[model samples]
Target: MNEAGDTGLAEVRVDVWLWAARFFKTRSLAKQAIVGGHVDVNGGGCKPAKTLRAGDRLRIARGEERLEVEVLALSERRGPASVAQALYRETDASRLARETARAERRMVGATAPPKRPDKQARRELRRLKDGG
Candidate 1:
């Protein structure tokens, strides 16, 4: 058991880890996401209060993006981005997949809707159709 003298607990809560690691904006949001099945710990679904420790793998799905990271440290309090980053490490495959998805999105930007026929366009189409 990895005990933190302050909490006197072997590990930190999953939701607290998520929030502290910058995965969610708030602990409530992290709990909500966990309850909603947006997060998986060690290939299995976990609850907000699930105990988390170093070396655990997590799968977090946020919108269309999914991140798989290995927990490197545990913390209950939120910190700056640099400190938060030290809490976990994203796997290489996950990083490559995310970049590929981003590139695909950029290449397939929103398509323009088909042009509608206005008064002039309608008349022209009608004339063409009528062989005039």
Candidate 2:
């Protein structure tokens, strides 16, 4: 049992926690994300090896998706998705916002193909896009 009085909980590195929680595919990627400022621990910037305790807040980004979760438990091993879910509790608003953003981006991307024109348009678009 840990300080939180939960036998399932453990103390682990932030990167490992993120990986085990399924935030990133690998610990290295999680570290990269942390260094890239795409992952926030306890509402502030943290290193990959920062120690994470139960109830800590994490904001993680995967591509265009962002997630906010509260650490419910900690595990160092990469386990199954179901097991991973047991380690954290995602906020409802975060889930909804991520889904909506993903849908909106998908829709925009799908419709954006026609917006790109030929070579002439490319030159003009570049000028406009770059504010040149």
Candidate 3:
């Protein structure tokens, strides 16, 4: 009913909107992020129950990717990915920075050891440690 052509009549909760937008797997996780100070609304900390309106700015930090997005629509219930995408618009700079950081992380991880050593590698390491 507000701007951005959103059909919803009422403002949505920040956590619910984040969940509906697929920012988090669940509303609980979104609430946790808000409480942890990883989410900022309009450049300041806000509660999970904060009402989100169209055109509001949100900054969310999830692991190595930080996102700056503008609320485009309000939805309390989660929907399909495409529909969820319509709920917010990520800033171009945020998208580019996220991609760059992801690439950097991939490059760094490419040189790291396997997450778990195989039996042969484990035996070899043990033998070397025992001076065998």
Q: Tell me, by TM-score, which candidate is best.
A: 3
Please write out the lDDT profile of model 2 over residues 31-118, one tens digit for every residue. Answer: 9999999999878999988899998999888887789999888787777788888888999999899889988988988888565588
lDDT string, candidate 1, 2-94, tens digits: 322233435899999899889999999999999999999999999899999888999999998999999888888787888888888999999
Candidate 2: segments with Cα more than 4 A from true spot: 1-10, 115-132
Which residue pairs show backbone clashes in model 3? none
Give lDDT per model, in order.
Answer: 0.88, 0.83, 0.88
Residue lDDT tens for model 3, 5-95: 3565468889988998899998999999999999999999999999988899999999877999998888877778888889889999999
Name the lDDT value of residue 6 in candidate 2: 38
Instruction: Identify the superior model by lDDT, candidate 2 or candidate 3.
Output: 3
Compared with the true structure, the alpha-carbon lDDT of candidate 3 equals 0.88
Total backbone clashes of model 3? 0
Worst 10 residues of 1 by lDDT: 1-10
Q: Which ten-residue region of model 2 has the weakest summed lDDT?
A: 1-10
The window of 10 residues in a row where model 3 has the poorest summed lDDT is 1-10
What's the CA error at residue 14 for candidate 3, in Å?
0.4
TM-score of each: 0.78, 0.76, 0.82
